[model samples]
Target: MSNLEIITESRFTTVFIIKMLYAFMCGAHLDSIINEIRELEKPSKNYKRMKPATKFIKQPLEGLWHKHYEQVGLKSMAMNIKQQMGLNNKQQKIFNNTFFKEFCDIFNNSEIPQDKRIEALGYLCSGKQYIDRINDGKLTGEWIIYHHCNGKNYYLNVGNHSDGDDALAQEIREIALFEFPFFKGSLPIFD
Candidate 1:
């Protein structure tokens, strides 16, 4: 039996005291017992004990969150997307619950830069056909872009798509080349 098992088995008040005293008298063995006690007192690292869903449930979704982000910038972006996509009340509600909530969660997790937040939201919403509605032979709005790659349809809000302005495309190319100096060839033309 282990030293901890022996220590715990002694229930009587006087007996427990005597056992501990005997362990301390043994010097080297006493250190192990003390170490075991310390280990038992530490907080658990077991993820099974954690409820990740509880965190999502408790996330601030209304009132203060809306008022705050609205005052900042996300609200304006959401409104722009809503107007451009012609979302009705019901559709707007669904959009808020899904994409907007996920966007807020990203910000809540860390102080992400505005550009990074936009890029993340664009990436998150990409590859979904529902947001890929076309208008006047072009993908409408700043929120969605439909691009064809390898016979598959992908949507992106950022990056060099055909609909993106020349300045924006050049900026993306420059950023890419600056970030990865080894890439000598041009980026894939997302037509």
Candidate 2:
């Protein structure tokens, strides 16, 4: 088997892993969870103001998405985004970098099922539905998710808040989830 293939090891190595697995399966990645925790860590950031949500922008995002994807590490973009929101803070920026680094670790681990990875990638699309926060000045985070396109190189946001991303991952997952249910494999769209 290729080194990238998903191995058949038991995923329930720990309760936290189990919970994480279930949560990811249900449309939330560690990034989102981390971001949520970060929000809680700073109540002044309107701790309870945010809510999870899903949205669609039928218009293609090719322009700005690609621009941000190419310019610099997401950390810069994340900082720029936060700065624009007047919520720029040092601690949270650090969390974003760590979250992205961990995301890579999870992406590379063979023990993680490809379907699950696809599910994570699926965040780019939303069968399970990419869970995103509603009120946390995270509108800019959507762009950060582009770092995960089909195993392409991913760059972490350097500064530090834990919003590995917001809209970007959800938009991708939404697309993936939306497309997943209709696939017939080789069965043909109609026999």
Candidate 3:
């Protein structure tokens, strides 16, 4: 998990504790509040006794998880293809399958609405470094590009697909569309 995810989720933890503390200060049930405080102060047990129902539920599913560890569904299975990409005269190496899944997970978990989530993904992926790399070159965009490789980040106009070598450019365009759909609006670098 990223540090930002941890921080955002932790806001709830802070709010819960503060609410409990506020009730204590307001003198709402002195004995119950003191007992609650004591309960929290006590260290949690290192081991938990497994419930019988949990065992019964999981018994039949034991080996099922192992067979599907790398893939959860059809969409994920489709992304499992291995591919390499390069730009700026160097190889860029990030597993597109893994990266796409990560973005999908983030978008799925986020509170943002589904259609708007794509815009959020675009903004997140199009950080200054990616934009700057493209601005320094012949390419143009406010859009962000994630090569199947990580280091080969670049910027290109939305719908402009003349990257990579002759054979690889089409494949690169396909991967770019899969990963960087945020370039709905990309301005040229020169006028």
Best by TM-score: 2
lDDT, residue 72, model 1: 15
Off by over 4 Å in 2: 1-92, 121-132, 135-191
Residues 6-63 of candidate 3: C-alpha lDDT, one tens digit per residue: 3222211222234334434643333332232222234245412111111111321111
**Candidate 1 off by > 4 Å:** 1-86, 111-115, 121-131, 134-191
TM-score of each: 0.21, 0.22, 0.20
Tell me which of candidates 1 and 3 scores higher on TM-score.
Answer: 1
Q: Write the per-residue lDDT of candidate 1 for residues 50-84, one digit (tens) a residue.
A: 11111011211111000000111344345434453
RMSD of each: 27.3, 21.3, 27.3
- Model 1 pairs whose backbones collide: none
Those runs of model 3 whose alpha carbons end farther than 4 Å from true positions after fitting are 1-91, 95-98, 124-191
lDDT of 2 by residue, 1-191 (tens): 42111221121113224334454564444565344333322335444323322222333322112111112245544444444334346745765565466567768979889888776744422221112322333333222211222323122111112323343333333443233333222112101
In candidate 1 the C-alpha lDDT for residue 64 amounts to 8
Superior by TM-score: candidate 2 or candidate 3:
2
In model 2, the worst 10-residue window by lDDT is: 3-12
